[model samples]
Target: MPPLRTAFDALARLRDARAFHPKGARVDGELTTLDAGPWPLPAGSAQVAARLSKGAGVPDGFRDVLGLAVRVPLETGPWDLTFSTIGSLTRILPFPARGWCDASYSSLAPYRVGGQLRWLLARAARDQPKVDASLRAARRLVRGGGFELVLSSATAIGVPQPIARLRLHTVCDDAGQPTFDPMLNHPPGVTLYPDWLTKARELAYAGSRAGRA
Candidate 1:
């Protein structure tokens, strides 16, 4: 188990420094279907709210980890699917930036796909761009009823394979706090990796939430 108190303390420091992504723009859409893919999600329409932001307060032109949070209505309850530009986690300080549109976002942890543990991956956008044009395009597609959110799986070696697509329908503002934690908000089929990094993140999120409260 992780030292929750220590993790919370670190999270408080990060918050105090304002070292994380602070500005997020929200959009409302619909999760139309989970196409023929690896994840075991049903194909149906569900309300969705998504938040897009650049991490570490980096300028739009610079390379930074783009953050995305997708909230979907599920039978169990409202599930928040959080993603970062990188497909995997790293211990190194100052995370590297992989282009947002072409970048692969993961649950930042692993999940059970095909009875084996794998990380959930999703393409941020279709094409690479320096600005937020891809996000604008996604918004347009959502309004036009043509946006599809595709998710994939990353292997132990960090290669991505197709999984499913969630069709976006409309756009609206998000109602919840901008911050997201995969350990607390993941869906039913998703699982976290059993490792120090995962535990640390769980603790950090708990601490951050406590600080906010």
Candidate 2:
């Protein structure tokens, strides 16, 4: 759990360093869900895309950043993300179908199996140290499944300074009940690209650094 929290914090801090506008640029577009597409490789893997409304004036660099590649497991459902700009009247910008997001990076699951095994093993290990039963069950369960990455965002309202919240939910369809990526259980220590948290962290950090300098 602590490791996951640390990773989230690192990701958030990374985003903050990049500095993105919360209200984002003026982007008019429709939001819709999509299935994974081809040409990106691993053909048949699910994917989603957002098409901005014409003449919306999205930043080219931001768009390029957002267009970065991401990967998710096969069992998970389609990805959904929201976008908004700084000083925008709308509190929430649902990127339902339109991909107004400025920056993007691929979401990868490197420890799906190992993490699952460790979690399951922890439960039994608490009861007994040397047990073959737990090991057997862990092996069987972790052998066949994977995880998913769902992207979403929120606005950080109120004083102290207004900001937006960008969230990514990691899910696994092993038992049909989706478990949010354990990563989001707490406020990330750092922010990643295209994430609202990133922008806020940058502002806060800059102010602190300036005061010291």
Stretches off by above 4 angstroms in model 1 are 1-19, 35-40, 87-99, 124-148, 157-159, 167-179, 187-189
TM-score against truth, every candidate: 0.70, 0.18
Q: Cα RMSD (Å) per model?
A: 4.7, 21.5
Cα-lDDT of candidate 2: 0.24
**Per-candidate local distance difference test:** 0.59, 0.24
Lowest summed-lDDT stretch of 10 residues in model 2? Answer: 117-126
Poorest 10 consecutive residues by lDDT, candidate 1: 87-96
TM-score, prediction 2: 0.18
